[model samples]
Target: MGTAMTNPAVAALIARSHRLGADPRTTNYAGGNTSAKGAGTDPVTGEPVELLWVKGSGGDLGTLTENGLAVLRLDRLRALPGVYPGVEREDEMVAAFDYCLHGRGGAAPSIDTAMHGLVDVPHVDHLHPDAGIAIATAADGPALTEEIFGDRVLWVDWRRPGFQLGLDIAAVQRANPQAIGVILGGHGITAWGATSDECEANSQEIIGIAARYIADKGKEAPFGPRIIKNLDKTVRRTKAADLFPIIRGLASTDRPQVGHFTDDDVVLDFVGSERLKELAALGTSCPDHFLRTKVKPLVLDTAPDAPLDEVTTRLKELHEAYRADYRAYYDRHATPDSPAIRGADPAIVLVPGIGMFSFGANKQTARVAGEFYVNAINVMRGAEAISRYAPIDEAEKFRIEYWSLEEAKLQRMPKPKPLSTRVAFVTGGGSGIGRAIALRLAAEGACVVVADRDAATAETVAREIGGTDAAISVTADVTDAAAVEAAVNEAVLAFGGVDLIVNNAGLSISKPLLETTEQDWDLQHDVMAKGSFLVAKAAARILIAQGMGGDIVYISSKNSLFAGPDNVAYGAAKADQAHQVRLLAAELGAFGVRVNGINPDGVVRGSGIFAGGWGAQRAAVYGVPEERLGEFYAQRTLLKREVLPEHVANAVFVLTAGDLSHTTGLHIPVDAGVAAAFLR
Candidate 1:
């Protein structure tokens, strides 16, 4: 990467790719591939040779780095056609591409490598822009190309992407010397230039012209007349919130799946349109869209204004039907060597008045799948207005979806983390022990909900964990039952449902029996005791409904056992939390929901409790400086070590994940060794 970036042509290609990818008009996320050919020094022969640098398989042009591009000798690539076994054996060519390496080659060459390499151009851009696809999927796309850009933008008939399609494109380029680009039938666009700038300009011109053509000449209602009016924004979102968990559960029948819901104006319009079922059944045209969105979306026939109970019943029936149809679709096209049926669950589900719900192994995949469908919608709109919206047939789609090359790519991906499919909800995650727990769980590959009463700090912690895919922040007062219920709902909507719950939200009121007012006891009890119970009760509904086993961990204190001075109210509340763990464990054991607790001595550093004046109060009682309390506490422990929040976080992880699956109703002490606080 370091040496390659120094080459001027390689640099120009990367810069151009970034610009094109950044705009949705040019390409969807990771939708297209771009390439440039340049001179490279042969290490052994000390001779200058032409090299091809193309965006490799599974890379996004917008965020491409030098390493993301594959390097190959142009001479070897151009020579492959001499021994071509034809389109039937084109998949083998992807393997042959390795032999044309300029050096160690870089990332693996994409399926589109031949298009860039065999086409006699210095720079090339192959894209799947919505506007370009709009025309490509049109029945008269070739005529439209002639009508709009004349011969300057040539047209290539539909051909599945392979060495043959590459050769087809190469032929088009060679024949039309004045043509800047070719509109690929039932796919997207490919443009080449004498230089990087010219190629980019050519691409933008084609997309802009197609977009304007559709805007001016296209019909107003491309999807046909609207059949159902949309519900109000609040009702729409509420419906989505209600259905998300149930849909997630149904979607996870084969394997656990995270989901994303989108009800934007575009999606709403499409779902409520008369052609919703027809267009969705036709599926997506572009390889990028089809690969992400599956063969076709599952379209719900229920009206938008149906009752929730009726909708749920009908949805279940529709879901089973979709799965059966998908299974049959696979059987119709599968061969002895075809990749094993991955799953029958539809990736994208379209519901009128509600929205689209897309599922995948993770949130990012689900979100991207949803976005690809939106692009497909735009393509459908334009194609319908100008000509018939024709996508590749089912047989062609099956060939691409189960392509052996794609299966190999999946096999090469690294194994997922232990908690990759799980989601964690951490209370009081804005600061202290909860924050540490949230960060730790996320690191282990769990999507996290950082819930705190303070919205700002919760947001800050969520940002630290990563983007919306990995974490989201929710503000709720746990003592209020409704707030606790709403907070759990947020987790369900953001992720699929809660797989783990860490009841760590609490503050302390330290005072001796004489000075402790009734208010002190009630406040501590309300937060630590009642809050934990409310959170557990609310989350249990989701976990049980998911029908997947889950975990609930309570963060108790050593004071729950030890009779520490000036800590009666705090100790009693901690004791209450500790017992709830056992109680829930016994009650929920039959459901496969493990309940556990971690009892830790005061973790002063990063402690939200300590920062809220508890540190000064405790220090005064113990005759030490507030900052020195940690050192004093460390000296008093049997291990002579101060307890840290991370220690408790580790204990929580151990109890919930991996080897400890069967163990439940257990309490692990994270106090470094405080004999007085130890369980008898």
Candidate 2:
């Protein structure tokens, strides 16, 4: 089900690849045909001329064709880039490009043909649209793009798409062999010469870059201690669920897709609108995201204890205001020929006590909204990381929001890539929980890098999965910074890159709070909290360097939330780990990385991390059982099953995959729903 594109799909893909390009969001008129021509004899047919695809006129790319394509010999076009620099005017380069297209008998070649030709890729297409211009016009656009793509992408200054642009791109490509695409400031992007599928993949990757930039720019500047207050759990869950459908609609394009849902009062209350707009005004993650999430968040001030009747009435009022703002926005910017706004819709909805709600037509769209909300929270968190986040100018926000080219770019997108080549690094990988996650990601075809403190343990598990297409194992002490860094480096070296990191190596210690010595705290922190952060930081830097984004998993415990006797150090450290993941999620998200935590309850197996004497103390304190520990733990859970390491690993796998791209900055409890029934 998760296989790469097949031959038929590949042929049809290349022949009809022109359908893959999106126009620059700023360009109001003109489309360009752009693609790569292979020069060396084709390995498949030994023919030289190979026109991958053309950005055809008169149709949405979603339904493109090979008939629309015009193949060209690569050798002829390759000579053009070298000659362009000697030419004096744009006309000369345009004429040269046209000559190549006419010689091949295709539609006039893309205006960017010279640039595309010089790159020597397998597929390519180019577009001119408005959304791109909106971003190009931003002050921070170039810096933001660089942050997202790292050194793998090239940025070209805004120039007409003939000789000048081609020359600029050629020089950059010559210098950076790993560069993938070129972003033209105040213009559209150019992703050339890959499979038609790869062309589309490049576009999505660009979108991700833009999304992260916008998210980073818009977050609030943080200040002071975070004062947390408890609230009614039932109301928060109900509201988050009620809002989930709309949130799905507003962000992700499909419903009942991508990810499953869970809501928590603690999470919601922490994010609710006591000062949400004051926060959102800080700006969006970046300007481009405004095309979907808008520039500002709608806020609700209702208290958690408010009556349902009052909250419902207030929500409707907020919804109406949002609709009114939409009409005003469209009216102010709509061109005479543009479509009219006839519906009452809210891009974002806020319900007091339930955090924020987003609306979408389907699950995919809702996921986008969820991503926006998550980023908004991150902005708030990051503001604390740096200075307070401040809102961008309204004109700048409008530039992105109202750009038809940008809106059109969102018209069609490539299907979500199956999580085929992703990799996950799980510490303590040989047996127990780490083994479970290693197996899960391996099953998904992700190279599973299993590292453990024990060399043989890691090797044994690595050997077991050696039969898989992507799986590896290594030995290291998670607490040892050098070892953790080496493990991450080895994974990156072995696998091209790492997309998922699960910090699951930890031990538990239980004793009376008074009996817990400073050494106990330091030891627990070293292996658990400090190790998780070290591993996460190492992987974070690598993912940041890749500029492709990644996922990080921290294996914490339920004790982080519910306190008893003994686990003072372990519980505190686990709690710190959870909080650290949240901070890391905010900081690294701009690079497309998502950080999350998994809190498992009573997952006793192999090495007994949870079998500390503190359990006896808790049992004595709560007057439960020492022998029925599993049942005693399960009694509080709705599912009434002793939590297992496998359960936590499975959750990590899902979150690390394509299924939960919209989720980050929160903790998912794999404790059979005990946390769900906590207040009850």
Candidate 3:
């Protein structure tokens, strides 16, 4: 086939990487692999998937699949690299590869096994692309890289392909414990980690750092050295110093790269050069360099005697023009299906004899620009013999520049509707609290599967919301572990993922401790406690396997904290549920699952529980008019308002949404004054 496989998860991952500010071209073409075991062949048999994952032969990594990847055995492939005759003989090599896999009894792996095997960490990555090769293959690459990375990186010149490269990397990593990633000259970079997502993150971070270094540290063009000597008129040096940090910040906050070039002569001369106009006309920097520097730089070559208004006007004009050009470039290339690229960015500036300017959104982007400019200079100098290096097409550039899904990912702040598309399964979804939570989650756009012991009630609730088709209502007693598993499986099969789960299905009783029988305790615990565990366990597997983060919300009661007289069985069982939330949060956090409990006090407004307690008994407890109990609870301090199911629903929505993205492992009070009273 001419193209490679693409799947939603891979697309999402690529989107995430892009949002982190990685070049789509750099990260898009290559495939990625991840597994559960940190460092084993397989978690089950201890056999490795060699490469663990390989990009399909011709697939676009922008859209790849778990199945599209070729999982090979690394040890076997490393051994075979030397024995193999040529690419044409790969068929024969496949036989030997099968033999190695057969040793582990039908466990097949990737051909890049040896490459991945070399990484000491659990995750490994390898890619070959022109952007990476452009920098790696340069003669002064290592020295230039060393100037930027210093002792933080491991830089290796080109080596023989296959096993030798892997071996060299392993040797370097073993020799240098501080190296988190490797830059293979003329090939690509490799990042490792304790987990797959971490490994992917490490890869993005290293590339970003490298890109930034290039933008920040590379040389400008040759000219007069130092701004003071080039300026025709002198200004207060103290004022210049004062402007330094602010200028730096303004320059670097929005570009791919900005660096303070130390080669004073190069900076000043280039700023004053006659070719500045021509270069600016063509575009600021190259397309790849756009991330390093916005397409062009601001030029200031007028005499130091120029008016302050003149200087201001020049800077403004240059910035505005560059923004216009960027928009034009975007408009010319982007398609109807593609998203717009934000182009009001100024990446470079030239202050005539004063010096050159560069900027990135951060220090790293500045560094990336430095490296890019150095390469640009080299490319220009080399063009004296051949053609100036032409960049990839505008369409390709737009594809990288305007990728939408990637843009949606870079939120360092809290957001709402984080779990909007997430699927949640709630027990007891028919009436009372369970139905409230399910409807609330659905209002937040979660595809909710409501499971209840009563079939008719479940169906009725599912239908009332006009979600008959989309909202699944499964009739299964929470106490039946098998039924819970089946329902969870059905949800996964339908949704492809599960992100939020509300364990609100429960049975309550108010018998005194001595009066509670063995059957009553067993039945209550089985439904309220064990049932939650079963559903959580099944959903956790689906989430952890997918590597997509998930959240679990347990519906508990205030009685779980306050041991009231004559409610021993219900209190104890609910307490167990709360405890389970804590333990599950601890265990599942590593797998990216967040668990929390919602404890409600006297929230049984219209439920059967209210029917059992509403008469004189409720009146005695409140000591108020029977009809005024709502106002009594509402005015019992704090906000002084009766709690609505909607209020509890609102709490659930916030916890599951972007508002409380960082919270986990605790009980939140949906009960107004009761929880606060105990605390006080």
Candidate 4:
């Protein structure tokens, strides 16, 4: 270890923490904390004092910055245990930590601050490693640790994290002065050393020891093959797509946001195991997981070739039962003095014969929950391979779940955006109205599927919004049924399910009835009329299956209602689309799928139709220069302002964002107050 000064010591600690947190095997998404004690001059007194710079609550160590570390006066933190009473010590400890802030600009200290302060060494690292937790949760964890490392490690019994836990660590250290680390039963491992490098090295060494031990034990006693004789053939991704939204609807408090589901190889393997029910009944291996995954997962039965409607009905029943069981669990554990907490709904769901599903307020949280559950599955398998898996008792779980300190971390999080967790599919999303709508939706936190006939443009637009999680690009001709189906599958694969569909793909043709050839008529009608039908049909299947409400917005034109000269084919096709939206609204209303249309006029800039020489042709018909055509149209409107693509996009947002939740089967004119195009 280098002979670094006090400031360098904290820097070294931060760097090392980032390295470990970046690896999922070491720590999954803000689940771990690290601290380093160093000498610093007090801002108020200008006197030298010891300070503990610990990872703050709700901060992700993987991407930690200096501001993410909470600095507290070590002397005050260390003195708290001596003065604290036995009752409500956790709350008292948090209050003390708040009072001891060294300079005050950083986030609140982590709940484990006292434990970090109590360690005698200069540097300390705490992490819930998958391998370490696997060993820690095994019934024979202490015995196994002793056999593996002899006296180099000390074992601590299960205790909820807070003031008492800090005292226990100090006691263990006193007994095992020469120990390099402590193995926390039913929790995690902690290591400390004189230098940051040494501390991290020790942490990794302990994890490596646990990993090898688990591997060897698994080889010695391999689990039997996971055989489910009557298990349905794995559900197809397309069919499984519909199941999550229904789950979201049931799980939500008021309005349902989208739910993201995953069924990777690991998830499928775990769910397919014959012992799935038994293993899942066992609690989560680590306490931190309880924040996201809860004590147990909801398991649903499935069958081969099950119809979507049947699966939806079954899920609704299971969800109701799950909520009842959660309420009962809370009632059993709640004390008269205890504050009422939210129901203990399962964060992760296991659908036998299909795979696992995780729910969150948004896509990011859902994905995080999925990641933690996957890690839990691996840890449980490893622990059982060595010995019977054992996790913290139910009482301990309740304490951690309801811990005021832990709940505060979530409460501190920023409010979600209006469309957070909603997924939208926008056809012709590469440019003009489609692109604007896609970007706008993404800005409001919706995961957008940018579907366009132009592959390159679709990809560019998707990248512009944000990669993968925010938007995904799919190339498909909406008029082609197979292509439309494929595009829908792409959206489901990327974002679980679709909550909004924007039918915005179209072209303009300025030809009189006599001049309009069959080819021209078919091209306009196929894209405007047939294309809308195909996309709507494909999306309707999913929306109906989801059973949660959804929105379908059609991008028609004012010409559809008030036909312009020499625009017969374009007008007729758009009219057909508008009529189709009304018919669809009539049929799909019972399923909570709202269908509506927006009739926009004179949105010439950036329009693909205008770029195809239609602008010049229309200008010639009106006896004006092509550049002045937009001005001419603007003057025609009562408002005398240009109707832009962004205006149309905003209108789309209003309709899809539940602003028009009570209104459907109607047309909204977005034409800058044009009397001719106004709806009567």
Best candidate according to lDDT? 1
TM-score of candidate 1 versus the correct structure, residues matched by position: 0.96
TM-score of 2: 0.39
Higher lDDT: candidate 3 or 4? 4
Ranking by TM-score: 1, 4, 3, 2
Root-mean-square deviation of candidate 2: 18.7
| lDDT to native, each model | 0.91, 0.59, 0.57, 0.82
- The runs of at least 3 residues in candidate 3 whose Cα sits more than 4 Å from the true structure, single-residue gaps closed, are 1-418, 611-640, 675-680
TM-score of each: 0.96, 0.39, 0.40, 0.94
Ten residues in a row with the worst lDDT in model 2? Answer: 251-260
User: What's the lDDT of the predicted structure labeled candidate 1?
Assistant: 0.91
Per-residue error for 647 in candidate 2, Å, reads 1.4
* lDDT comparing candidate 2 with the true structure: 0.59
What does candidate 3 score on TM? 0.40
lDDT of 2 by residue, 1-680 (tens): 01112335335554444334323231212333445443333445756444433443333344344444444455666666566555345546654655555233334444455666666566655543333333444455566557667877667765544566777877886787777676676455666434666766675566566545555654442333333343456545544433333332222221222212323342354355345555555445344245445656566556656665575566556656766776776677666755444244544554445555554433234345545455445434433333333335555555445444344544544453345546678887877788888877776656678889878877888788774235667788988888886777666444434668888888766777898889988999999888888888777766664455678888887777877565689889988998898898889878888888888886754433545464555566557776666678788788888877678878887787677889998788888887542422
For model 4, the local distance difference test gives: 0.82
> In model 2, which regions exceed 4 Å deviation?
1-418, 605-608, 611-627, 675-680
Cα RMSD, model 1: 1.8
- lDDT string for model 1 (636-674, tens) is 998999988899899988987778999998888898899
Better of 1 and 2 by lDDT: 1
